[model samples]
Target: MAGAQRLAQTLAGRLDTTFTKVGTPRTPLDADWQAQLASALPELRQLAETLTLRLVEGHKPLAVLPRCAAALATLPVIARHHPDACLIWLDAHGDLNTPASSVSGYLGGMVLTAAAELWDSGLGSGWRLDQVVLADGRELDQAELALITQYDIRHLTSESLTPEALSQAIGNRPVYLHLDCDLLAPGLMPTEYSVAGGPDLAQLYALCSAIGHHELIGLEVAEFEEQPDFAMAEAAEALCDALAPVYERLYR
Candidate 1:
């Protein structure tokens, strides 16, 4: 929660935008796989509120989809509220796991599929798959690869996305960017769950700047563990600074 608050503060300070901090409840359901999710319901819903507060009011006390689903739910409101918005999903894994298929037992890994509705869930029923663009994704399982191929979702693999390629792919869509810090190479950003070998800092900044040239609704940086590392925080602050101007152009 402190991490999220810090991120919000960083964005508000860098972009000169309004930031609202909401509190979430702690659920004590269980430590096992599915039940652990229920425990996070209150906090997740609070996050959902934070994501969508610009568009609507009222707290819906439900277990929202972990990360991807949360993003999916927020997108429609962003699109409706700011119709020109597009989505850039930056992660190491495709995050397209269903309950039956997921071997890791991690709910965060399943977020993308839930948002895509490739997985069965009542929580993320609101997102349309067409609005999303996958960028810098790697380490996809076979089934997840098939799903991405089946959907024909536009994705640029970490190896393939030169700065030029990334800029062209974004192609002037008003973007809502979701950055899971794991997309960076492991040593550079050790706080994330992504595999080794990804774009370097230069490429990342270029991509963010390119996408920022378009209208940007909101941005979310997820999957940072609470351990404080000056290097990690500095990287995050730089990324936010690069993205701030684009955010300013859109919201301010």
Candidate 2:
């Protein structure tokens, strides 16, 4: 959370616009978690419409992402202005495993499926699996691989996250960028979920530049720990530097 807050501050200093903090729900996720998020939707939506750039910082529990996605969908800008806004999910894991197919039963692993809710009972949100573009996920589980094949969701491999390919994936829709810190290469980012063989720092900056120049409605950087190691600190600094251009592009 401190990392995110610091990033927000950094952006505030560099960019022409101020970074407004859109508060996340404090309630612990339980059976009524969806309802809790829904009740908070109006306020979130208002902020989305009002603020130039809203940076949402959180622990980013996968179980709560579906609810978060629900609230984001209701953002008056997305719901009213850009109805065709799609999600760009940058992560190391596929996050497509369902409870039945999951081997580890980790809630974070099922985030994309939960957000899309294409199979299970949905959070009554607008996102569908078809509207998501998954990038840089090399740590996919067997079940996730099977599900992606069955659903035909666009999975952009590490080799495929190039500028031309990303442009094609995004097409004409505005984007909601969801960046998991673990998307960085294992040694680059010291998050709990870091995986090897992901994009390096140069590729990461290029990736950010590619999609960020497009129509971006919102940005969320998640899974940052309250306490970071030396490697994590370095990684976070690099991320902020890369995104400085993205922040500039938002106004352009």
Candidate 3:
């Protein structure tokens, strides 16, 4: 059981979502994000299609994904209908690394950069840099930092993640939210990447509540690892307990 599935299923029990397993792509693992995308794009394309169908049919998606690269599907699909919608990316890292800049070459790190046409991901770049808001991004790579300065993308630090502040930043524009659970404090939950100095659960709840007002287009969560101590469902419940208000607002 992967962490994503466990977290998603647990979240489903609490939120207004139906749990469906979107299976993984089976291909020889490539060295970096770009090579991986190139190798498994065919299967990933099918995965995107499924998400697209559900979205067009009026489903508010709660996409639980292992890698942020899965946002390759979510971002483009949501942008198709709501081009003007602001994508509020809630994560610890910038995830803005381009192929030329990424030192680690992690696929998740390059997802949004690809969506912004910084690189091609075969799914088409439907999102623009200006239409994105990066919140709670504290642990940024030097390459990501340069890109931010170069593009002047909107980013909010942890202190500025208040609902009032977000509402002011995103007035009258509907929003698509992506959560990488590592945005929470390292000891708070299990995630692939654990950077120090993340927000606590209370702050996460407040951020979600604030975004609820922006008319959530859809939401996707990544980076949540399966916990060994608590049951997966229990961990999900504890971690997402604060986000209930956001779910109620969106699902209601």
Off by over 4 Å in 1: 16-18, 24-30, 56-85, 228-233
User: Per-residue lDDT for 4-90 in model 2, tens only?
Assistant: 555566555555445545555354445443454456557555554443232333111111122223334333333344457777878
- lDDT pick, better of 2 and 3: 3
Write out the backbone clash pairs for model 1. Answer: 86-174
Best by TM-score: 3
| C-alpha RMSD between model 2 and the true structure | 6.1
lDDT of 3 at 206: 80
Q: Report, for every candidate in turn, its global Cα lDDT versus the true structure.
A: 0.61, 0.61, 0.80
* Each model's total of backbone clashes: 1, 0, 0
lDDT of 3 by residue, 1-252 (tens): 288877777777776557877766354485766577777677668768888888888887777887777788678888888889988888999999887888887888888888988888888778889888888799998888888888888888887777788778788898888888888888777776888888888888887877887777777888776667736666688777877766667678
Q: RMSD for each model, in Å, please?
A: 4.5, 6.1, 2.1
In model 2, the Cα lDDT at residue 15 comes to 53
Whole-model lDDT for model 2 versus the true structure? 0.61
Candidate 3 TM-score versus the reference: 0.92
> Residue 180 of model 1: what lDDT?
77
